[model samples]
Target: MRHSASFLPSRKTRIIIGTLVGLFFAIPFVATTEYTFRDVDGHSTIHWANVFDPAKQAAYRPIWTGLGNSLLLMVVTVAIVLFVLAPTMILVNLRFSKLRRIFEFFALLPISIPAVVLVVGLAPIYLVVGRSMGTGAWTLAFAYGILVMPYAFRPIQAAIDSINMSTLSEAARSLGASWPKTVLRVLAPNLRQGLLYASLISVAVVLGEFTIASLLNRQNLQTALLVVSRQDPYVSVIFSLLALLLCFLLLVVIGRAGNVGSHKKGRRK
Candidate 1:
C-alpha cells in the first residue's frame, strides 16, 4: 500500500501560492490601458476618454512627490516612537510588574478609544504643541505618536515577551553585570525584529492617519489624497495603490518577525 505524504504543505508550495496571487493582482494593472481622472476632491470628476492620456501621465508626477511625503512622515513617526518608547518599555520589563501591566494596558487603551475621540482629544493638544514647535510634518509626527499606539505597541510588547527576560536578569545579577549592561547588551540583541517591527508599524499608521492629521490641519499623505480626490478619481486610484503597497510592506514585516532565530533556552531553578 502507498503511504500518504505529510498533510502539511511545504514552504515552496506556500511561496508558489503567494506568487500566483501576486501575479493575479498584477494582471489587472498590466491588462488595463486606461488612465482614470479625478477632480481635486478625489472624486472621478471627469472620466477621461483615455485612461492613460498623455496629460494624465504628466499630472501623475505630483502624486509621486506626495507619496514621498507620505514615506517621510512614516519614517519620522517611527523614529520618534522608537526613541521615546523603547527605553520606557525596557524599564517596564525590568523594574515593575504591576506597573508594567498597567502601562501595557494603557498603551493598548489608545486602541479602544474611538478614532473620533483620539482626534478630538488630540486636536487641542496638538494645536498648542504646534504653536510652540512650529508647523509642518514633525508636528504631524507628534500627533502620530498617539495614533501609532494601537499598532506600535504590539510588536514592542512581543519583543519584551519573547526574552526569557526574567532569566536574563537573574543571569546578569549572578555575573555581576550592572542592570543597564544586562538590558543594553544581553537583552537588546534578541529584540532586533521587535525593534524594527514596532517602527515599521508606526510608518503604516502615520502614513494613513487621516483623522488626527486632518484635525491638526497637516498636509500628510492621506490628507493630500483626500483633497486631490475631489478633482480626480483616477488619482485616488493611484493613491489606493500606494496605500496598499505600504500595507503589504507592513504584513511582510510581521511575517518576518515570525521567522527570527530560535528563542534561547534558559536553565530552570
Candidate 2:
C-alpha cells in the first residue's frame, strides 16, 4: 500500500517554500556586496552576461588562464576520482574489512588537518614530484586527487552499501562474465549517481581551489578570482556571477539526470 497523503505536500507548495528559502540567503549575499556594473554610456548593466570586451581582454588574460586551469582541474579531478579512487575505495570497502578500516582512516585523515597546514605541506612535495615527473599537471592532479579522495570515497561507499552486490556478482558469474567485466559492466552502472556526486564535489573543489595552486605558484580559478578583483572590482563581480551561473547550471543538469535515471528504473521495475 502507498504511504498516507497527510505526510506529503503538493509539488507547487514545495517549490514555493524552496524558492523563498533560497532567495532569503541569496538576496542578502548580493545586497551586502557593493560591486557595480555599467555600459559604455555609464548606463546600468546586466548580471551574469559576458561583460568582457575583446580589446580590454589583455587586462583579463590572467582570468582566461585561470578559467582554463579551473576547467582542467575539473576534468583531471573527475578522471582520477573515477579511474583511481573509485576502484580503490570500492575494492577496499567492499572486498576487504579490517584492512579497509585502516586504509579508510588514512583516506579521511586529510580532513582532520587544517586546510592551511595541508596546503603548506603539499606544495613542496608537489614541486619535488613535479620536477621528477616532467608533467606538472600529473603531480598537481595527484595532489588534487588527495583533496578529491575524501569527497569521492564516502558517496561511493554509500552507493555500494545501497546495492546488492552479491546478487549482481553472482548473476554475472553464472553468465560467465569475468571479474573485471562484472565490476565494469554490472557494478558501475549501479554507482552512476554516486559517481556523478563524487565528480561534482571533485570539480567544485578543483575549480575553487586556491591554497595549493597559489602555494605551488600555479594559477587556478580562486587565484584568478583574486587577481581580477585587484585590478577591477566590477570585473571580479562579473566573474563571480559567471561562476555562480555555471554552478547553478551544473546542479540543474544533475537533477535532470537523476529524474531520467529514476524514470528508467521505474520502467524496468
Candidate 3:
C-alpha cells in the first residue's frame, strides 16, 4: 500500500505538471494568435475579416480547395478503417488467432517507417493510381489509410481484447445470424468506443498530413497552408489555429458521444 501510494502523484504535483504541459502548448498558440492580429501600426482584425471578403476569395481559393479535399480524405479514410481494417481485425481475433502476431506487426509497421520512406515506396504505386484514377485528391485516402493504421489499430484491438470475441461471434452465428449480421449486429456494438476513437484519430491524422500529400502531388489542408503561408504568413497561421481548434473540438465531441453511449448502455442494463 505504501509503495503504491508513493508512486501516485500528490495533488499539488499533478497541478504543477498539468499547468506546465498546458503552458507548453498554450504558449505557441497564444504567440501565433498575436502574430495573426499584428499589422503595421498595431494589432488588428483585418486579416480575420479578409478571410470572408469576396474580393479576396481568389487569394484564399487554394485553402478552400485543399480543405475540401482533406474533408473527403477524412471520410474515405475513416471508411477504410471501419469497413476494411476493423473487419479484418474482427476476423483475426475471432477466427484466425494464430495470425494475430503477423497482423499486428504489419498494422504497426507504418509507425516505425518514416513518412518520407513510405512516400518513396508509395510513389510508383501512386503513378499507377493516378493513371487509373486521374489523380483526384480523394485517392490519397488509400495512403492515409495505411499511415493511420497504427493509431487506429491500438484502440480497436484493445476493445477487442477486452471482450470475448469468440464467444460473442459464436453465439451470434448459432442464432441463425449470417456472418455479416453477426459482425454488424453482435460484434460492432461492443466495439463502438474503439471504432469512434479510430475514426476520430484518422480524421485528425488526415487533416494534419503534409509529407504524404506533398510528395504525392496532391493538395490537402496542410499543403494549402504551406502555399498560402508563402504568400501571406498571417492567413496561414489563422487557418492553422482554426485547424487545431477543429481537431480539439472533434476530440471533445467524439469523446462525449462515447461517454453518452456508454451511459445509455449502462442504464439499459
Candidate 4:
C-alpha cells in the first residue's frame, strides 16, 4: 500500500514557493529599474547623472516639495496614532472592555469610505483648516491619521493582547504608581514592536496617499510621482523603484523590531 505524504509542504517545495513569490514581485521591479537605466534609444546606461542634473533640479522642485510634505504627514500621522489611539485603546481595553468592538468598528470605518467620498466629506473641514492654518501640506496629517487608523489599530491591539495589561496595571497601582505611569513605564516599553509596526504601516500609507491630497488641491509624493511620469517617464520609473526599495527597507525594520521584542520577552521569561 502506498503511504500518504505528510500533509505539509516539503522543504524543497517551500523553497520553490518562496522563489516564485519573490520572482513574482521582482519581475516588475526589474523591468522598471531596467527601463529607468535606458536612454531614449533604449540602450542601457547609468542614468544617475541625468537624475541629479543641476539644470533639471528646477524641473523636479515640485517632487522634492512633495517628498517633504509626505514626510511631514508621516511624522504627524504617527504621532497622532501614538498619542490619541494608544491611550484610548488602552483605556477602553482596561476600563471599558465592552466598548472594544465599538472602538474597532470606528477605527475600521475609514476603510469602508472611498477616497473620493472621504475627500468630499472632508471638504468643509479642509476649508476651515485652510483658513485657520494657512493652507499648508501639514494640515493633510489630520485626514491621513484617520485614513491609517485601521492599519495602526491592529498592531497596537495585538501588542496589548500579548501582555496582561490588567495584571500589569494592578501591579503598578499596588506599587503606588498612577495610571499614566503604568501606561508609559510598565506597558509602553513592552509594546515597542507594535509601535514600530504601526509607524511603518502609517509611513507607507502616507507615501502612497494621493486622492484626498489631490482633490484638496494639495501635493504629495504619489501625486508628484504622477506628474513626474507625465513629464519625464524614465525619471519617474527610477523614483518608483526607489519607492519600492524604501518600502522594503521599512519592512526590514519592522522585522528587526519584532525579533528584538521577541528576544527581550524570552529573556524576561
Candidate 5:
C-alpha cells in the first residue's frame, strides 16, 4: 500500500537538472554582462560606468519620464485590480459559488486575447479615453488593469477558497456586523496575502508590458528601455539589468513577506 520513492528524482539526477537550469539562465546573463562591457574597440572592458548617472538620466530624459509613467501605471493598476477583484471574488465565492468557474473563465480571457487584437478591439474606447482624459499614464493604467485581472484574480481567488466564507459571514452577522463591515474587517484581513500577491504580480506585469503600451502610443518602462537601447546600447543594457535586479529583489521581498504572513497565521491557529 506504500508508494515508491520513484516519484522523486535521485540526488544525482536532481543535481544535473539544477546545473542545467542554472546554466540556462546564467549563460544569457553572463553574455549580456560581457556585451554591456565590450567597447567599440572589440575589447571586453567597462565601457559604461554610472549607468544611473544623473547626467546620463538627463541625456535620456524620455527614459526617466517613461519610468515615472510605468511606476504610476503599476500603482494605479494594482489599486484598481485589487479594488475590483477582491470584492467581486469574495461575493462570487459567497453568494454565487456555482458560477465561480464561469467567472474564472471570463477573468482569464485576457491572457488568451492577443495584444494586437485587443488593441484593435479597443481602438474606439482608447480614442474616447484619450480625448476625454487627454492621454497620460493614467489612461494606460486602465488598460493595464484589464490585462492584469487574471493575474490578480488567481491569487485572490485562491485566498478566498482557503477561507470558510459561510462560517465567517454568519459569525459576523450574528455579532451585528453589517455586510460591508463583515467584508472589510473579517474577509479583508484573512485575504491579505492574496492582495499582496495580486499587487506584486500586477506591478511586475505593468512594468514589463511592452506590446499594448507600444501599440497604444504609451511610453512605459519597457518602451523607454527600447528607446534608450537604440541610442546607447551599453547604457540600455545596464539599465535593463538594473531593472531586472530590482524586480528580482521585489519578488524576494514579497516571497519573504508571504512566508512571514503564513507563519503568523499558522501560529494564530
Candidate 6:
C-alpha cells in the first residue's frame, strides 16, 4: 500500500494539476468559440446558422472542396499505413529480425526532420508526380504517408512487440496457411487496435496539415480555411472548432471500441 501510494498524487495535487491543464486547453477553445459568436452588432449564432444556409453555399464552396480533398487524402493515407507500412513492419519483425533496428531508424526519421525541410525535399519529387499524376490533390497522400509514418509506427510497433509474431506465423504456416493467409487471417486481427489507432492518428495529421498543402499549392481543409478566413474569420473558426471536435470524437470512439473488445475477450476467458 505504501509503495502504491508513493506513485499516486495526493487528491489536492491532482485537482490542481487537472484544473491547470484544463484551462490551458479550454481557455483557447472558449476564446475561439466566443469570437465566432461575436458580430458587428453583438454576440449571436448567425454565423453558426449561416454555415448551413443553402443560399450561402457558394461562399463556402471552397471550404467544402478543401474538406472533400482532405477526406480523400485521409483515406489514401490510411490505406498506405494499413497495406504498406503495417505489412512491411510485420515482415521485418518476423522474417528479417536483424534488420528491425535499421528499419525502425528509417521509420522514425521523419519525426526528426522539420516540415519545411521535408517540403523542400519533396518539392522536386512532386514536380515529377504532378507530371505523371496530373496534379490531383489526392497525390498529397504520398507526402502525408511519410509525414504520418512516425506517429503510426509507434502504436503499430508497440502492438507488434506485444505479440509473438514468429511463433504465430510459424503455427499458421504449419497448419497449411500460406504466407498471405497467415498475415491476413492470423496476424492482422491481433493488430487491429494498433492499425485503427494509427489510421485515426493519420487522419488527424492529414486534416491538420497546412504547410505542405500550402507550399505545394494544394487545396486542403487547412488551406481552404486560410483562404476563407481572409473573407470571413468566423467561418474559419467555426470549421476549425468542428475539425477539433471531430478528432476528439474519433479518439474517444476508437478508445471505447478497444475497451469493449478487451472486456468481451476477458469475459469469454
Error of 3 at 167 (Å): 1.9
lDDT of 5: 0.84
**Whole-model lDDT, candidate 1?**
0.71
lDDT value for model 3: 0.92
Counted clashes in each candidate structure: 21, 0, 0, 0, 0, 0
Computed on alpha carbons, the lDDT of every model, listed in order, comes to 0.71, 0.76, 0.92, 0.87, 0.84, 0.92
Estimate the TM-score of every prediction.
Answer: 0.70, 0.78, 0.89, 0.87, 0.87, 0.90
Candidate 4 lDDT at 17 equals 94
**Model 1 spans > 4 angstroms off:** 1-68, 166-183, 259-269
Question: What stretches of model 5 exceed 4 Å from their correct place?
Answer: 1-3, 39-48, 254-269
- How well is each residue in 97-186 modelled by candidate 5, as lDDT tens digits? 899899999999998998789988777898998889888777888888989998889878878877898899999999999999999899
Model 2 regions lying over 4 Å from their true place: 1-24, 32-34, 39-42, 46-50, 135-138, 251-269
Q: Could you give candidate 3's per-residue lDDT for residues 1-269 as a string of tens digits?
A: 77867889889999999999999989998898899898799989999998899998898999999999999999999999999999999999888999999999999999999999989999999999989998888899999999999999998997898688889988998999999999999999999889989999899999899999998888998999999889888888999999999889978987887688678768978
**What's the CA RMSD of model 5 in angstroms?**
3.0
Candidate with the larger lDDT of 3 and 5: 3
- Which of the predicted structures, 5 or 6, would earn the higher lDDT when compared with the native? 6
Which one wins on TM-score? 6
Off by over 4 Å in 3: 1-4, 7-24, 253-269
lDDT of 6 by residue, 118-195 (tens): 999899999999899989989999999999999999989978986789999999999999999999999999988888
Residue-level lDDT of model 2, residues 1-269, one tens digit each, is 34766668788999999999999988865753434555556546542244456667787788888888778777887899899888876677557766877877877887887667887787777667777886444356767888877777876776777688778878998999997998899989988888988898777677667787777777777787788788766777777776777777776876787687668768978
Name the Cα RMSD for model 4.
3.1
Model 2 scores a C-alpha lDDT of 0.76
Clash number for candidate 1: 21
Clashing pairs in 3: none
Which lDDT tens digits does candidate 4 get at residues 1-269? 22476677889999999999999988987887677778767666556566788888887887888889999999999999999988899899999999999999999899999989989989999899889898888889999999999999998998998888899899999999987888899888877778879989999989889899889889998888888778787776777778878988888888788888789778989
Better by TM-score, candidate 6 or 1? 6
